[model samples]
Target: MADKLKVALAIALVVAGVVGFYLLSEQALVLRVLSVLAGVAAAAAVASQSESGRRFVGFARESVTETKKVVWPSRKETVQTTGMVFAFVVVMAIFLWLTDKSLEWVMYDLILGWK
Candidate 1:
């Protein structure tokens, strides 16, 4: 009975949230704040209860811990990479322009005799 009531209350909160959001969609600020409050209340109720909630909490904690272990590149490394990319693009652009000019010259002056 007690578990049923908790589940019902959580479901009610979420349903109320959805209805409220639909009604308040024209007022973005109020809708967002109310939606967040509703979500937090629902989460709190869920966390207060059975085995699934505990597992969810543990998973969330591990995710945060794993996120903290990431290593990021330095600014110097980023700048060097950016410079190399730009140099490659410039070289490719020049090569393409030269190839196009050579093709144009051969088609017009050599074959069609355009001078």
Candidate 2:
């Protein structure tokens, strides 16, 4: 029951923040933005008390930790792999073009005599 109420309040806070932004449009842009941010912080604080929100926060923290443990490829390895991929693509393009031209020649020049 308490968790449900906290979640609802969090949603309400976010909605109120959006409304406030529109309502305070006549105010200075910086002040209005700060107010909206404060509302978002409040909403986050309220939401963090809920079970689902806590789980999400834990998941985000774990994701960051796992990201840090990743072994990224070095710059040289990345560049070399990229160059090889480009070379293979060019070779395939040339091969496909030759095959297409050969088929066109056989169909039009030799078989149909349309040339």
Best by lDDT: 2
Model 2 misses residue 20 by how many Å? 1.4
In model 2, pairs of residues that clash are none
**lDDT by residue (tens digit), candidate 1, 1-115:** 6666766666777777777777777888776678858866885676468565667778999999999998877999999999999999999999999999999999999999998
Tens digit per residue, CA lDDT, model 2, 1-104: 98999999998998888888899999999888887898899999999999988998999999999999999999999999999999999999999999999999
Model 1 regions lying over 4 Å from their true place:
1-18, 25-28, 31-33, 36-67
Give the CA lDDT, 0 to 100, for residue 102 in model 2.
Answer: 99
TM for candidate 1 is: 0.53
Could you tell me the TM-score of candidate 2? 0.81
Query: Could you estimate the TM-score for every candidate?
Result: 0.53, 0.81
The deviation in Å at residue 17 for candidate 1 is: 3.6
